[model samples]
Target: MTTSDDEEINPVTMLLLDQKDDDVSQPNNNSNIINIAEVVVPTAVEHQSYHLNSITSTLVIRQLPSQGLSFQLWPAATTFVKLLDSYTPSNTDPFSLTVTNAVTSVNCRQRLRILELGSGTGVVGIAASAILGADVTVTDLPHVLPNIEFNADVNKNVVGTRGGGVHVAALSWGKVEEMEGVGREYDMVIGSDVVYHDHLYEPLIQTLKYLLLGDGDGERVFLMAHLRRWKKESGFFKKAKKWFKVDVVHEDGPSGKSRTGVVVYRFARKDAVFR
Candidate 1:
């Protein structure tokens, strides 16, 4: 009689394989388990959203911990900003609707040369361009341009190959005189979620005054989106009114607990000389 040789499988290995096989065979039964496993698995990408200016769109993004990031740009008309007014501060980002509404409210017309200040993710200006059909220039600190440019490139295909404009350049509010080289007075100037720091209030106001066009039959308008903050000392809107006719475009309800107002300010230089 010949001795028969047999291979032995480790119990743990067999159990794992058997489990996997069961998973494959009874897909419906294991669906919940698979979902729970997926949920527990560490994901490289943390989710994010960007407002794209070149096409007037809001882009949803996910940043992979290992790889870089991926984005999908969609028209704001398609993706509405959620109203998270009463949620706990930790659960939401306060600026979403404030910026979206401010951008949507601007009265820009085609060929209404426009400028956006602190164009973070380029949302306000882009929405203005798309809705108002104006050529838009997006300006921010130099460091912020790459993301803005990258987003513009990704969405260019959808917005189209021509007409709307997106130009990126460094524009610290106080440095307006330097940016004069870019040429032309903007018909409309806009900013959103930009005035948090106390030191910035003055410079931000100065930026508006410098960029505003001389009054020529009501062509020049400046719009700002602000949420009331603890940093505000006093007479903030009063000071702003000194330079322009301020209007409260829309105000959030008592539920809007974030310390800012969803405001739209239209500025015209008090001394703007009309032809």
Candidate 2:
């Protein structure tokens, strides 16, 4: 559904009541966005484990709700982990099946290099590093880097064993300097539940523009995993479509009185040229 028309959501913040759910379809409780201002943060530690077929044990991540939204795990991140776990050079399901010459073709080029935006708790990015054996950089605001670093360090054994590595950086979206520093060496960019705050739409777009329309050859893909909470999120997509070709590569059915589940959208340059 994209929750199409006009309204939409993402910031992973701003009036959203962050609830931890295993099966996104069922919420333990329902709360209005307005009252979310009073949402309580549990001091308890939040931990999640993702088992990787390539690794002997599971990848572990710790969430600090007391620190704020940036420290918590979001629903869309889980969806990305699911895809990364089963990714392969020959598998054509989501990458090739829906996105055409996206993922499957990318593996033939070189070692996969991925950049992740707003990597809260560093779950998806860490998982991608180990499972795909792709060198990955996980970035977010300056404050969030420590925690991401912690998670990355904790799983260094797994990443190193798989021949992939994870790097943590501080990237505040919309900062030209930060964007330029990150560079465009990556073949793919990924994010989950990143489009939450309407105010950040332009900044997020600017960062995307710099990276997707970057210097290099071949195709560069941006895969964003999102769960639409408000109809206004359409504005973000509307504005994004103007700069890049946006397509929904994956979607999960609506859960817990919601009309849409986590949706993974592939963004590429309309001309399909990275140079």
- The candidate that achieves the highest lDDT relative to the unseen native structure: 2
Candidate 2 worst ten-residue window by lDDT: 23-32
- State the weakest 10-residue window (summed lDDT) of model 1: 8-17
Enumerate clash totals for all models, in the order shown. Answer: 8, 15
Task: Compose the digit string of candidate 2's lDDT tens values, residues 200-225.
Answer: 99999999998888666338788898
Over 4 Å off in model 1, which ranges? 1-110, 213-218, 231-235, 254-261, 271-275
Question: 68, model 1: CA deviation in Å?
Answer: 17
Instruction: Please give the TM-score that candidate 1 achieves against the real structure.
Output: 0.57
Which candidate number would show the highest TM-score if scored against the true structure? Answer: 2
Residue 257 error for model 2, in Å? 5.1
lDDT of 2: 0.76
Cα lDDT of model 1 by residue, 1-275, tens digit: 22222221111111111212221121111111223544854433333444444334444322232322112111221122222122122332323333343334445543546777776566445545544445778787776677667655655543343355667777876665646754446655666556545577788777666666443524455656544433342345566677766655445532122322344444665653322
List where candidate 2 sits over 4 angstroms from the true fold.
Answer: 1-42, 54-56, 96-110, 215-218, 273-275
